[model samples]
Target: MGKYAHLNILLAEDDSSIRSAIKAMLFDLGIHKITEAADGEGALQNLIRTPQGYDLIICDWNMPNKNGLELLKDAKMRAPSTPFLMITGRADEESVMKALKSGVSGYLRKPFRMNQLESKIKVIADSWSEMA
Candidate 1:
């Protein structure tokens, strides 16, 4: 029914409304295995605690305590091959390129629909599986 059948997704978002919306959308797409963190700090803590619990991580670029880029760096350093995606309102070319070079699996701009989310998830899932 969905492009990605089953996956454990880590979502790091500071906004409560967006977090709820994202979870609802993902659930609607038949993805229920999700972990939420309010900020990058909490996201990192979660990752460190459960390193292999997730198949992918969707992180916000800007947050109160550690930002997404910082979190991405930390995650890659810790897990090395874990795919970390950056979903943010910042859509500038410089930021996007920086994220790619920093080992971000993918980047999506804000105000995106559930379809966009699904597509990115599928890409990450497919690539990760291939690599594995």
Candidate 2:
């Protein structure tokens, strides 16, 4: 089995093309159980509705209705243990600090490679194992 095949991931990104690309990458990593949302609000709704909740959340920084940071904060409130990966084009110190403060598990900068995504996921998985 793939390293992340057991994970249920929620993806929130306003850009369809980028979402598709990330989905493909996730599949390549052997993660098939992905729930996608075109905006942050929809993603948050999904999080609320999923009784078992997701294993991880991958979200874009900018979106209509709610941004990724807002979603991250809200999701943390709902499912504090679930890991969150924020994808952002903005790499400024302020933006990074804000996301960290909101409790983002990791980050993927715009135009990331599959290996980079895998590395981030591996880190999350390792952390979970440690906790277990």
Candidate 3:
């Protein structure tokens, strides 16, 4: 099993191709327990349904119904302890600041490699381990 095999991840992305690619990467890392959402709204619904909550939440910046920033705020209110990672093509300073202010654990720009994703996840996981 991979280092993160025991983790349950929530992935909220509107693009099918991007979502599929991320899911495949996660699978390669031995992270099989992933719950996917086509949009932020669906993601929120899934989050609400999962009372025990997920180990991590990876979300996009833009989507139909609701956006990642909105979802991040709501999720933080509901599950403040859960780590949230914002993955998006938006690399603007304003967007980064907004997400950080909204309590995102990490931010990753789009077109990132698997190693980049892995590194981000590792940082978040390491922080959790430190807290524990």
Candidate 1 wrong stretches, greater than 4 Å: 1-5
State the C-alpha lDDT per candidate: 0.89, 0.94, 0.95
User: Quick one: ranking by lDDT, best first?
Assistant: 3, 2, 1
- After superposition, the stretches of candidate 3 with alpha carbons farther than 4 Å from their true spots are none
Regions more than 4 Å wrong, model 2 = none
Candidate 1, overall lDDT?
0.89
lDDT of 2 by residue, 41-117 (tens): 99999998998999899999999999998899899999999999999999999999989888999988998999999
Candidate ranking (TM-score, best to worst): 3, 2, 1
Q: Write the per-residue lDDT of candidate 1 for residues 1-132, one digit (tens) a residue.
A: 665547888899999999999999888888888899999999999998994667889999999899999999989888888888799999889999999999999999998999898888889888999998
lDDT of 3 by residue, 4-81 (tens): 999999999999999999999999999999999999999999999999999999999999999999999989988999
lDDT of 1 at 88: 95
Per candidate, the number of residue pairs that clash is: 0, 0, 0
Determine which window of 10 residues in candidate 3 has minimal summed lDDT.
123-132
